[model samples]
Target: MSKRDYYEVLGVDKGASERDIKKAYKRLAMKYHPDRTQGDKDLEEKFKEIQEAYEILTNDQKRAAYDQYGHAGVDPNRGGAGFSGGADFGDIFGDVFGDIFGGGRGGRQRARQGADLRYNLELTLEEAVRGKNVEIRVPTLVGCDECDGSGSKKGSTPTTCPTCHGNGQVQMRQGFFAVQQTCPTCSGRGKIIADPCRSCHGQGRKEKTKTLSVKVPAGVDTGDRIRLSGEGEAGENGAPAGDLYVQVHVREHPIFVRDGNNLYCEVPLSFTKAALGGEIEVPTLDGKVKLKIPQETQTGKMFRLRGKGVKSVRSGTVGDLMCKVVIETPVNLTSRQKELLEELDTSMGKGEEAAKYRPKEKGFFDGVKKFFDDLTS
Candidate 1:
């Protein structure tokens, strides 16, 4: 029998990209997998077909040859036998399936690992910094109780397919082309089940919720992820289970904004308090602390509280907290208060240079005068 087109088996166009061909084959591999079908000899053939289609389409040289000669261009009888013999069928399955399952190269079909999963966990900044033990509910696929992963009815075993003689594939001829295809009767597994399990319906898995206790280390910020090995979805055909990743998102606190391990926050002070440089109360994750503002402190003056910020998980050292002081202008002033302020402003002098307390103010004005002098000159 002449070979059929590789593109036809994978259900992709001849001009399909390597990525497109892989996507089509992956869908078919997952849907018609022998692991999912449990002794449906027909499924075994289909699985092989999906595997074969992927094997040829993903390789650059093989794909190029197939595109040029269709199936016959690479067939053994037409002097292409070496190319066919050179391809390792098992390696191809391992290559694609390993990436999906996180396994290493060398595509061994059995003993596969489980899939990885993620859970979004929200926490207060305090709790995240202090570290906590949390219980999470996750949905996953577990082994089926009815079939015990055999996919056969109770008290029954699967039988090899009759049409393909347990090879799971059949030879087909079209005009001058001869190709091998998955046996339709057994789906490619080379086995058949006269009676399927009722609970899982021949699939060896069932959906159930699992409770896991995750230990969150201290000082985790938003967007940090925790990996839980062997905690993801169950693998098919009794392969290894997948891993679970817990993504952390910290809630905002009324007091602080975090940057790395540093904390930034605004502290409000009365006009008198800011002008006179007084001691004020400050908030910290651990507790309240007192900060002393130097006399003549202006608005937006930041005070650094050493060793008061969060302790990093990677580094043991604690970080500093920066408190930006905001001067609150006096509002609802009494008549006497307004009169006193006006008298004070008049006393400070009309030129107003004495009113400025910031460093380099005189230098800045002198520079500005010199700038125009240079411009005109």
Candidate 2:
């Protein structure tokens, strides 16, 4: 039987770019691979033919020779394999399944980093703003003291794996290709423990609870995290340990609510104080300070006290505390107080005089009158 054109086998045009050729070849290779075909002889032959075509076309010099002088210039049977290079099968299989089975050039297993751990630390608003040293208990894996992380007994040590002879990998010949894989007997460790440690039981690590002190900086808010290096789980076979993260959660304050760099609170004021005005004591993080309420101050008036809010964690800048005044009506009035209020209201003004003294109330009533007139008219 005659051989088919390489371009036709890969379903790509003669002028196709390297990327297009690779994409077409990968698609065909996956479809016709012998493992997927499950002992189908025709698919197996097709897979071999595709592999042969891919080998010649992917090499620059071989491709150039084949293009110039056709198959006569590059057929292995005719001219010593023409750049299919004997290693093509290994290279192709490595590219296809290296990540799937963790197989590659060396095939030696590597130690993995230990898993990270998270510790939630609850804090009061005051503590978060002032900072503190907190102690945390964490349960994690630690290297065994008896074996010193080697997994062998104190008096005896591990020996080189007899199966792979300390190479950690073995080669298996399949059809016309040789595939390199990790040794199953040693599990790719390259060394086998003859005597196991009593403490860690040949695992090289044991679970234990450790107490660590974490220094928290001031101005840290909820959701802030502090990282402690090498404080997590112990790695296998002496690998590096992971990190421990301290997550902060701030409790709500009864008096103040924090917003970014600002603090907000509602201040209640008596009606007499709101109207007559006076020096009042307001609470602050530091201490109480006197705030002078101006005469005739209305409800919902905002007062800003600079440098009284939280200092920013990142920027180191101060913020302001905003106070909203809410006027409280007098309650539980005595008979004499009620009579005095009525007499005072009557003495204040009437009609045009009332409008001059209570302009806002007069205007609201005028608006209501106009609304009703508009509907009736």
Candidate 3:
């Protein structure tokens, strides 16, 4: 029987790009793999045919000859120079399944870096505004001193694995295909410890507490991180240690609330201070400053204290502190004080001067009267 077209066997068009050809082949190969088919001879044969098609179509020279003069031009059985042996099959299989199986040229794996760690550092609002260097205690894995991280007893070293002969990989034959996998005996270490260390028990690491100092930059808010390199858990064997991340969490201040670079706070003003005007002391991050209340100042008035807020960590721009004045009513009253207030209230009765003195109150009452009148009408 004549051989089928390579593109037709892989279910791709003749003009299909190399990417499309590989994708079609991957789908068919995965579908017809003997491992999944479970010894079905027909499916295994189909798989072989698909592999043959992919091997030819992916090769530049063989694909060119096949495209111009068809299969006979490059067929090895017909004495033409094509894939006469399975020289490139390993490369193809690795390219397809290497990620899934960790397949590669066999050798001992590198020592993996230790896991990164996070430490939540709570900071006061003042501390976040001003930078501080803090020391922290961390419990993590460190190299064992007993065997010098070699995982063997003193005066003895690890021996090469007998099963894989230190290659760290063994071959699994799937029909004509040989898949390289990590050796079961050595667990890919390529070495066996005859006598394990008493302290860390051949793991080469032990649990210990380490003290590290972290420098936190100024104006750092919540969620900001300071990285301390090589301060995390020790690596396996002799690999480099991971990093430590100090995550900042700013505690809520009772006096002020921060918004980006700005600060906001409500200031309680006495009724006398709001009406007669006075110099009131307001608390700031730096120090107390006197804010002059204007004569006849009303409640809910906002005062901006420029350059009195936090400086941005990134931009270094200063912000203003916003103070909203809230007029406070006196709780305890004397009979004489109540009498004086009554006299003052009578003096400012419903008149033109009363409208000027209490414009907001008069306007609110006028609005309420108009609303009720509209409802009745």
Candidate 4:
């Protein structure tokens, strides 16, 4: 039977690019692959036809010849075996399914990089605001000292794997499919250690504890991470080391709470000070500062102190401290104090006269009276 046109076999037009040809081939190849067809001779033949079309269209000279003179220009029976022997079948197969099998075209393996690590560091509010140099001990893998990370003895070196011939990967054929897998002999390292190192036991790294100093910058809050390069686990076969991340977690303060750059705290004000204006001491991050209280100040009143809160780490903008004053009523009154309080209460008369001293109390009761009168009416 006459062969079908290569473009028609792959379901692509003559103007299709090489990328489009390969994409079409992969789709049809997967559909009619011998393994998926399960011994169906027609589908297997269809798969071969797809492969042949893909090979012809992807080649520059053969594609040009086929486009100009049809199949006669590059026919296998004419003088050569056509484009079958030009490219490696395994390479084409690997290009399609290399990621599925976790291997690529067989070659010497490169040394693997080290693994990253994370260490959580706890800091007090004072320490976090002021910053400090902290010393941390980390247990991790370090390069072996005996063989200098070679995984071999002091006097000997590694040899190329005999099974894969130092390629690190071995080809596997399942029916019509070709796959690449890691070589069992060398475990994908491409080299075998005949005489293993005593320190690390044929491994390029050894476990040990290392002491590192990390500088915590000022104004670093919780969830902030400090990266220390080349401080994580040692790489295999002398590759570059990974990084260590120090995660900062600030401890809760006893007197103040931090929100972004601002600090909030509740200040206790005496009843006498709330009634009569006076200067009261309020606690801050730096030190105690005097805050002026106005006459007839109510509870839950907020006072802002400029430039007394935390400084932002990113923008360098200083914030204000918010102080909410809570009035503290006097307790455990003596007989003389009680009599004096009763005399002061008597001086302020009931009804309208009392409203002059406590206007908020009068307004609240007036609202309550109006609400009940409306409900009854």
Best by TM-score: 4
User: What C-alpha lDDT values do all the predictions have?
Assistant: 0.76, 0.82, 0.82, 0.84
Q: Write the per-residue lDDT of candidate 1 for residues 191-230, one digit (tens) a residue.
A: 6777888887877778889999999999898867788888
For the record, the alpha-carbon RMSD of candidate 3 to the native fold, in angstroms, is: 18.4
Candidate 2 lowest-lDDT run of ten: 80-89
Candidate 2 lDDT tens digits, 140-222:
99989999988999999989999989877777877776777778888878889989999999999999999999999989887
Candidate 3 lDDT over 1-377, as tens digits, reads 78888889999998887768878988998999999999999899899999988988876556876786677557655433333212133433443465345455446644567766779999999999988899899999888899888889878899999998987777777777777777799787888999999888999899999888888888988756788888888887777887777888999999999987889999999998899998999999999999999988888999999999998888999889999999999879999999999899889887667998898888998899999999999
Per-residue lDDT, model 1, residue 155, is 90
* Residue range 305-330, candidate 4, lDDT tens digits: 99998887879888899999999988
Best candidate according to lDDT: 4
Q: Which stretches of model 2 miss by more than 4 angstroms?
A: 1-96, 99-105, 177-182, 350-352, 372-377
Ranking by lDDT: 4, 2, 3, 1
Query: How many pairs of residues collide in model 2?
Result: 1
Q: What RMSD does model 1 have?
A: 15.4
